[model samples]
Target: MESHERIQAACDFLLQSPPGEINDVLNDVRNIISDDELLQEGIVPALKRYNLAQFITVDVPETNHQSIISEAARLSTGSEDEESQERWLDPRSKKSFVFDHIALEASDPQPFEPNEDFETFRVALEKASLNYLLAHFHDGVSSAFSNQTTPNQFILQVVANKYNPTNFWSGRWRSEYIVDLNDHTIKGTILVNVHYYEQGNVQLSTTHSISIALPPAIVTASPESAGTKILALIETEEGKYQNSLNDTYHEMSEKTFKSLRRALPMTRSKLDWEKVLGYKLGAELSSSKGAFTSGFS
Candidate 1:
């Protein structure tokens, strides 16, 4: 086994190297650490695991042939006619070169300088909301989901962020409980946006903004209880909307039927349904009955 000091020295050298010398540092690391140890310590295992052969390499060209004696003497004497200028190697002259690193257009890496600000009270509610769903909410067919990313990067945020979460790339019915954390017994609008698009131009989506006050004992309640309560609140809001929509549809149907019955557009008169119903009822009742029950035939 290698000594601890030896490993420490090697690691220090690697960490000390500048970005320009990273490739050379990697080589040095390989030489200092045996292949087996390298694999154990996660140095070379990446290459083996991926079955990788090709790699990006910085330019390391061979030295050019020596210039003629006259040319060498002139360079040693230095040029006096023109000012000195920076020189650069032309990539086209080289045998081969790698393409520059690939990057998507308009893509910006996430910033880390501003240490993630965790809203203590807000996060508590968010966690509680998630927990409540996990512990208590159970739909026989549909399942619930919370943001699987880091706690700092959840869908529920204290303030609106400039972002466009592309949810339509995936197609399916999904119910996610996202918190809108706030400081109150009454929480902010929890979101249940059911969105999806499929082939054949079929699509469906709806955003359910639910608001509710937590139980006095929610803080004392278990996470599961809290999340479940959140879900319950969402369901309650949905139920209210469902009833409202149904009532509206009923009213609309009644109004439409009345308008239809009032008069025909071209004929401007209602059908004589009294006489028609009278004939229909008389015929229908005596359709298969005897003379005793058949009246006014």
Candidate 2:
């Protein structure tokens, strides 16, 4: 029989056999089709059609060696001299080598969306949104702290008060998640608008926008396995959540104070400062962490 006909017969036999017998049938077929070239030309397409591409490797040739070398040389030297670059650009040059034995592992030929179930996609988006929100809050706090003047207790108190974790815990922010089916990414954003009266005359406002991109692991995982993987990630980070919250709050307090110094320079030491800012911040962070955990769970 022709190589193609034999491969087709093997595929048909395997499809009709019980699931437990597939491995035996595959081994038998592999023994019969001993030639790698014949197997690539005949059996590879059949395996892909059966969703068994992962079981085989096919040798494919790389035809663009000249382009690859030219591009590499151009990038390495950052040079545009055409005459000096002709050696690497010539395909027939004896100095150039062709990568003819490129072996490609079989992968799912279908698009990523079809491989993923909707539930996994939704879970990935939720995770992405939560991560974005927390990261944004953390960065804002860090930025505020880094820009503040040291040893200024009044500024620290003012910043802590203005960025109270309650603002986030109270659900006053806007967030949205988008699943890009084509690109296999979960994109999310968290937005917060802060408006405060500084010195009783000027109203200061700023908008904080945080964005995140999540991988396609959850979406591409089998429905039965995706939830377990997500749970594992959360459990791994559970113990550190509260500590992270506290550190973020500390940084935010410093940042807020710096902003206040620039906006209300004369009132920095004159404003009625809250004496128990530390206690209030701790309580707010604890509350915010609880809210975040509950939402993620």
Candidate 3:
């Protein structure tokens, strides 16, 4: 399928569909495409490129002091006697017992904490998983575009108010370098970026370029599956058109992946585009003049 067709398919999928229809779209496309590379990379990445932000909320079980200890004992110990002994002797163990609700507040695009407890620590895990999905989507797309796996040169830039200046907090300010220790009202912005080159050179575009914005969240549920869930949504053509796309996706993914591997590595770095580029990818975009132009100026 041509790039134009792909773009049209994406727009159609997004336009008429309600904001809550991510799951059906995913399933509809999933049936049409069999290859994993085509499904993940070509399809999903395309959605993100079109300025979609997926929002999902995970239901976390809140615990108190007693419940935390009980749950920990149930998880860590096999025998009942061992659990009892550990609970009796461990002070830190006692602290672990009382887990409660964690608050993630969006204040100043950062996670702030006035008071923190063990219940709030789970936010770190959630953030990590969210980031992991973002990474996975990128990898899936890069691999699909090219036949080979490419090193993720994409840098995740995140801005938050809380940082550790204390000597003990050294190196903890960076993503993956440090973990989010508190869950109290966590709010922040994360930007994922990558560099694109064509035929061993940057695809310099004096006339037209591409940019992206945050995508909205798509929620899905199944009575047979894990109940309610939210995840990144991707779309593809249906029936014959869908089959054609799958074929193109398979072929293109191999070539794209191979090219990516041979080309320059996308170094892991982040940039604040709003500040550095003086423009947002989606909000401010324009097209080159019609094909009547003779050549590149």
Candidate 4:
């Protein structure tokens, strides 16, 4: 079947059984357009809608993580313009976040133990990354997180579905690194993606990739020593995005949202909150009693 048709069918399947497990839903998409390059184009939105709105996270298959690396490989090879790359590569666009490149270089590449060395490096980095991610992105709220380490890259994703029983707010975070394993030296990019949904109140989402340069001897360093440096790297990037989220959230809640709940400005200027609330509340409440008391009582 065609890609759009498959996507539509997947959407229909979701609407029919919205509570289907994330893996199951993704598997269904995988069956349909598994060969198409636009695999994420269909699966991502379907998964986002289904996972963000309907269900808490489940065991996301390791294939899901590897697919990201595969996508990175595709993006690197494709000759598409930067804009197209961003549109397809970005997990979300609500915040217009962009990705930065990460390049790992080596002065003297050496042949080392293959799988074992990669595994050691991957485990050390993942262990440190998960800890930092929880500290920075999670804000102490309990979230479902996954870190996948491969010979080529590492991916860490976090999903938070709990809200004030309203199901109005949902969020997910993902970070991935795509690396080129060249004997001893490696090269690649690391990216962080965040998506937040607030029904009626806000929807703030973006995936920004920041460029990071890996140490030349990263693959050769001792696991402990490598982890320490990688920990510092994760700390730097996660810290940057943490600040971005904070600032954007403030802008959204403090400025952009006023139009949704506050009185319209008639003179093309900001509305006087004091006067608007006073007049609106005064007309509805007995001025002799506190508005809260009168309304609740």
- For all candidates in order, the CA lDDT equals 0.36, 0.35, 0.27, 0.44
- Native-to-model Cα distance after best TM-score fit, residue 13 in candidate 3, in Å: 1.3
Off by over 4 Å in 2: 1-171, 194-216, 223-297
Candidate 4: lDDT of 246? 91
Ordered by lDDT, highest first, the candidates read 4, 1, 2, 3
For candidate 4, write residues 143-226 as lDDT tens digits: 211113344454333332323325534344444444333433322233322223344434444557755666677756786677
- Cα lDDT tens digits for candidate 2, 44-113: 4444343221111121123321112212111112344432222221111112222211122211211112
- Candidate 2, residue 20: how far the Cα is off, in Å: 62
lDDT of 1 at 91: 19
- My TM-score estimates for the predictions, one after another, are 0.28, 0.23, 0.19, 0.45
Clashes of 2: 3
Tens digits of per-residue lDDT, candidate 3, 4-108, equal 465457545643332234445656755655444555545533443222232211112231111111111112224654422222111111222211111211111
- The collision pairs in model 2 are 141-252, 144-255, 145-255
Error of 1 at 222 (Å): 0.6
Local lDDT at 199 for model 2: 38
Give me candidate 4's TM-score against the actual structure.
0.45
| C-alpha positional error of residue 32 in candidate 4 after TM-score superposition, expressed in Å | 21
lDDT of 1: 0.36
Native RMSD of candidate 4 (Å) = 14.3
TM-score result, candidate 1: 0.28
Give the TM-score (vs. native) of candidate 2.
Answer: 0.23
